[model samples]
Target chain A: SAVISQKPSRDICQRGTSLTIQCQVDSQVTMMFWYRQQPGQSLTLIATANQGSEATYESGFVIDKFPISRPNLTFSTLTVSNMSPEDSSIYLCSVYSPRQGGYTFGSGTRLTVV
Target chain B: AQSVTQLDSQVPVFEEAPVELRCNYSSSVSVYLFWYVQYPNQGLQLLLKYLSGSTLVESINGFEAEFNKSQTSFHLRKPSVHISDTAEYFCAVDQAGTALIFGKGTTLSVSS
Candidate 1:
């Protein structure tokens, strides 16, 4: 099992600003994923970050808008850029565990853009 | 590609009553099934998963799910629920250790 510590639990930001949410895992992991959960909606994958490679984003998401950084096996960050009210959501980081056949997730960073 | 459908958006049940959260999936190949629970203001926690072998999988907290391959369904059930069981539950699928494809989620509201 991996424990992830995410910083800035909740933040209120102005529109057009950017906020970087960091996720630090206790163990080394091959892949880290970022997700968004809007109010009254299910989680949607934003991107997948692998150490030492460019992040792979899902449909309707782009690196320019939600850039990701995976500096090493145990750490990753997701930046929400050019924020808007529509972008206000809970951003989460998850790491897949093959042995467990599941993913361990961070507590999530709640963002409110005004 | 894979997709999961959690038929019920919300389920309200009285405490100590049986509850079932239905989940169905669509996939062209073999897949793994998982159930996750999310409490208020927290990240999702794994409830249980079906990888291989027996079709029935049980979680520590008395939650169980039956994997019916023919129907492509993995519905979560608890014989009796508690007030603490009130939370959003998600059903997900993955093929060969890939990223999980999640359902829309079912909100289980266990009340008195």
Candidate 2:
């Protein structure tokens, strides 16, 4: 199975600030997804990051609010722009691995906006 | 489109007791089912999945889930649970070449 290393496991930020979460996969994968799990809520897909292309954002999400960068096959980053208290949530990255026969998720970044 | 439903928000049980976490899903196309466990302040770990073949799938641990197509259900069960089994369980569904859709997780609390 592929291992994903996500940084900034948690953070406390002030409103109007920005935070960029990163995920580095041990193995190269074609597609990587970003998800946000609000407190006491289910996981919601934010965007899909494909190498060498602009990410495809979900309906409720926008490029200006949540910009994704997929520089290469094994690396991706998601930035929460102009954070607000409502933006506080646990963000996770995932990759579908054929060898593992399922999706592998990162440890997740917990953001708290005040 | 696909969606998952976890009937229980929380399940409390004593150690060594039998437990079941119910899950149901709806999808127009053929889909895959997965059960994931997330410990406190940690990431999600794949518990088990039913991709094809037999309807029953078991994890390395005691947890098992049976895929029922007619009922559109994939409920997880363990004959005997341990205190270590305490965690949030999530049921997710995914169609071929698509992203996964997750259910609102169920938190399992196991005590002595």
Candidate 3:
């Protein structure tokens, strides 16, 4: 099992500002994913962070808005840019499964925009 | 595209009673089904998963879910409920080991 850690467990930001959430895994994973959960909603795949390449974002999410960086295996970051109250949600980092058995998740960053 | 459907958005049950959380999915090809639990102020943890072989899977905590291919369902069940079981449960489906499409999530509130 891999131990995943996320920085800034939570933060409240002002509108128009950007907040970057970092995810660090104890071991290298085959695939790393980012997810967003809006209040009273389900988890949505935001993007897939592949090391040394551009992040593959899902439809409705743009790199310009949610830039992702995977400096190396085991380390990744998701930046929510030009934040608005609508951007307020919980961002989570997850590892693709059964390597750690099922899916291991980071604690998540709870961001609230003013 | 694969999608999951959790019929109930919320379910309230008295502690020690039986509870069931329904989950259904739509996928043309083979897929993996999973149940996850999220406690307050915490991250989601996998409750169980159905990869292959047997259609029945059990979690360590006495939670069991059956994979009904004909019905396209993987519903979670616990014979007895507890206040500690109050949490948000998510049903997810993944085609292969790739992306996962999650259901809206069902909040299970077990009260005393």
TM-score of chain B, per candidate?
A: 0.99, 0.98, 0.98
- lDDT of all the models against the reference? 0.93, 0.93, 0.92
User: Candidate 1, residue A93: CA error in Å?
Assistant: 0.4
Q: What are the clashing pairs of model 1?
A: none
What's the TM for model 2? 0.96
Q: On lDDT, who's better, 1 or 3?
A: 1
Q: Is candidate 1 or candidate 3 better by DockQ?
A: 3
RMSD after CA superposition, every candidate: 1.1, 1.2, 1.2
Could you tell me the lDDT of residue B75 within candidate 2? 100
Q: Which one wins on TM-score? A: 1
**Model 3 bad stretches (over 4 Å):** A98-101
After superposing candidate 2, which stretches have Cα over 4 Å from the reference? none
Instruction: Report the error of model 3 at residue A54, Å.
Output: 1.6
Residue A37, candidate 2: how far off, in angstroms? 1.4
Q: What is the DockQ of each candidate?
A: 0.70, 0.71, 0.72
Distance from true position, residue B53, model 1, in Å? Answer: 1.4
Over the stretch B1-112, how does candidate 1's per-residue lDDT look in tens digits? 7999999999999999999999999999999999999998777889999999999999999999999999999999999999999999999998866688889999999999
Candidate 1 whole-model C-alpha lDDT, 0 to 1: 0.93
- Model 3, B1-112: lDDT tens digits are 8889999999999999999999999999999999999998788888999988899999999999999999999999999999999999999998766877899999999999
What lDDT score goes with residue A71 in model 3? 90
